[model samples]
Target: MVTSIASVCLSGGLTDKIHACAAAGFDGIEIMDSDLTVAHESPEEIRALCERLGLRIDMLQPFRDAEGVDEDLFADTLRRAREKFRTAQRLGTDLILVCSNAATATVDDDAVTARQLGELADLAAEHGIRLAYEALAWGRFVNDYRHAWRLVQLADRPNLGTCLDSFHILSRGHDPAAIEEIDGEKIFFLQLADAPDLNMDVLSWSRHHRLFPGEGSFDLVTFLTHVLRAGYTGPLSLEVFNDTFRQTDTGRTAAHARRSLTWLADRVATTDSHDDRRIPEAQCPHAVDFVEISGADLSTADHMLEQLGFTFRGSHHRKPVRLWTLGTARLVLDEQDKHETPHLSGIGLSVDDSDRASARAEALGAPPAFRRTHTGDHELRAVASPDGTQVYWNDQPAETWTEEFTGGDDGDSSGAVVDHINLSYPWQDFDEAVLFSTSVLGLDAQASSEVPGPRGLVRSQVMRSPDGVVRVPLNLAPPTAPTPPRHVAISCQDVIGVAERARARGLQFLAVPANYYDDLAARFALDTAFVDRLRRLDLLYDRDDDGEFIHFYTPTLGDVFLELVERRGHYDGYGAPNAPVRLAAQRPAS
Candidate 1:
């Protein structure tokens, strides 16, 4: 299956967009009319560049509001279409896309629509151009793909066929099963986009909130499967209209789009059981082996860890790194990256097979991250995530890597294990991070929520493995905000005990305001004594029908923080209700 992305999906001039698409390994691209109109290069020059870059201009898109108008308007539409058709010939593209009119279409008659489309097809044929008609989700008359196909059938022109867009169809909640009812040969193009479930009108939803495959709430696999079942074999192209992608780096956006199509096409291939393009199956992470903090000096972090009940495990034999462990939770401190403050720089995940996982990452275009390994040590095989964080995968438990740290207390009773990792990303990096968690690590993305914070609303989405052994919450920080601190949440057997011990060790926790306790009491109707104890220890609390959650946070140290959490009676949440209080209490890089 050849992969392509629309020029509108990326940012830059046409040359830059084409180069990024080619470098990102896309086989083709859809040249939007707007991109072409604004580019300094002529159509012939753009075509020559794409040829040089080994990219095919799949289609010239999209001629909008081309049909279903009065005789006067229809004449003007044809003249405009003729000019675009001439442009398509120069661009060396045979295909042109026409969108159903969302404005100025007074005629609701299918016969009129079909006749107008047929006339437009005749004009396109004069230039040897084939037209693919698509139904915009908010089109005046032909708003559904089924309706668009009916119009195509009525047109009965060889050069005219229907183009199916996943967003247009899925956003309207139309039945995708009807897609198979159309003739395969008549389906000329397919555009794919995934979007979160939004409550606004379709036009607004489409222009601002489209996401790539596997990053949103759409069932694109089933949608694509239906298209395949109908025998549509054209290139799989992406037409996302995300505001973030438009503003992000051109190369990065193009690569991210390519990865999404790869992931989607691979899934469709697996389900359809054909070898068009093979993507390695995901290697679901089994456990978080360890998280590493790196800086010029990590003495402050080291002290914070000890106060949180982590036992210092000593230094590595061959490198300037040390480890601390509390029960199954482990942290590795590296005295490096001298230019930056202490930060959560890397994470090691225990998977069933490291080699297979690394292969999957490579196939998805993740850049390989490297670290030196001395003789008789585990090779530090890793990949850099979209946000520059290094992700290391190992087949063995973290203790295998911890073996380098020779001297440590073996029998600690801290009763703590890594519950989840909270990573805050810039606005542009959020969707890519979500896709990374889904495609690379095989984690299931849960429903996302927004928490009000001091700066703005924080968008939170969690990606977790099947057995719930590994969880990573991806948070979308506000646009104007600075880089948010990343924290490691450790689930303990007893939260009050842990907080008391840390307090006894003279560690300053992020203080919770008194109003939080009042709200908790009002919300849950908890016992006064339990509420008093929680308030005294600065602990935040929440409860659902399933169980209760209690957690506390440490003050931010450099760009990192620590969280101690305790779950009672099968609670699965991350104490989301307490997030606002935590946000208000957190200092701004003090």
Candidate 2:
């Protein structure tokens, strides 16, 4: 399948967008009209650059408001179309996208619209160009793909056909199965985009909130399957109009866009057995083996862990790394890198087949990470995440690696297990990280939420394995706020007991405001003694119909923090409602 992206989905001038798309492995690009209009290069120069970069100019978009107009208006629209057709010819592309009138339409009759489109197609044919008419979701008269297809049929022109955009069709709740009924040859172009479910106006949502496929709530596999079933073998192009993508680095955004298409193609191929292409099945991790922290000086982290009930498991014989554990939660502190500051650096996942997981990640364009180990070591394969965090896969038991530690297996067991890991990313890396977690790491993205912070709103998305063993909550720091550090949460049967013991051991907890207890009293009918205990220990509480969640945080240790949680019953959430209070309390005072 040919992969393509619209130039409008990235930042920079026309030439820069083209170069980025080519470098990212895209086969072609749909050149947006505004990008070309503002570019310094002539159409011939743009064509030469695409050829030099081994990229094709798939389409010159969008010639808008061309149909459903009076005769005088139609004549002027044809004049505009003629100019664009000349430009398309010079740019070495044969297709032009004409979106249905969303602005000014003097006539609403289908016959008139069809006739005007036929006239425009006749004008386009003079320059050896084809017109792919699209219906915007907010178009004045024609707002559905079915309507647009009927108009294409009515026009009965060889050069005029309907363009199917997933956003315009699915955003309005239209059935996509009907696409199977349309002739494949009549479908001139196919544009794909996924988006979060929002209750705002269609125009605003389409322009600002559109996410790439597999990153949002759209059923793109089914959507693509139906299109393919109709025998449409054209390029699978992306036409996302996101505010963030438009302002991000053109090369990085293009790379992310390319990954999304590769993931979507693999998904579609997996669902259809008859398809020849097959990608590796997604790996399901059974447990988190360990979390590795690295820095020049990790003594402070070692002391903090000891205070929180973790017992030393001794240092690695061949490397400058030490292990600490609280029940099944293991922490590996690596001090080999003397130049780096304290940071949460790596994670280890236990899957059924580690080799297969590493191969799948490599197939999806993730770079392999290598580590120095002795010949007797149980080699762990790893890949670097988009945020520079290393993720290692291991199928062997803990004893295989634990035996390498000098101090032996006599460490304290605090009855705690890793509940989840929280990772914060800069605004630019958020979507790319989401795609990486879902496609490369084989995790499923749950519903996301926005939490209010001191600087602005923080967007959070949870990605987890199907069996609920592994969970990663990805936080996108507010664009205007400084990026926050990452943290880990460990769960125990009795958080109150653990907190009491840690406090007695001199572990400093993040202070809770006095008003929090009063608010908690108003929200839930809890015993006064329980509320008082929560306030005294700086604990936070949240309850849903299924269960209750109680948790508390420790003060930041360099760029990492810790949270102890107790989950009662089947609490599936991460206490999202309490996020604002936590963020506000964590903010530094002026």
Q: How accurate locally, in lDDT, is each candidate?
A: 0.91, 0.90
Give lDDT: candidate 1, residue 588. 69
Please write out the lDDT profile of model 1 over residues 15-102, one tens digit for every residue.
Answer: 8999999999999999999999899999999999999989999999989998889999999999999999999999999999999999
Prediction RMSDs, each to the true structure: 1.5, 1.7
- Summarize candidate 2's per-residue lDDT along 1-590 as a digit string, tens digits: 68999999999899889999998899999999999999999999999999999999999999998889889888899889889999999999999999999987979899999999898999889999999999899999999999999999999999998899999988998999999988899899999999988888999989998888988888999999999999898999999999889999998889889889988998999887635555676677888899999999999888888888887899998898999888989999999989888889999998888889988887777789988877898899999997789999889897788778887458656668899999999898898999999998888898888888889999999999998889999999988887887899999888998888888988879988989889999999999999999998899999999999999998886788889999999998888888888888888788
Worst 10 residues of 1 by lDDT: 406-415
Clashing pairs in 1: none
Q: Once model 1 is optimally superposed onto the true structure by TM-score, how far is the C-alpha of residue 540 displaced, in angstroms?
A: 1.7
Q: After superposition, which runs of candidate 1 have C-alpha atoms over 4 Å from their true positions?
A: 411-413
User: Which number leads on lDDT?
Assistant: 1
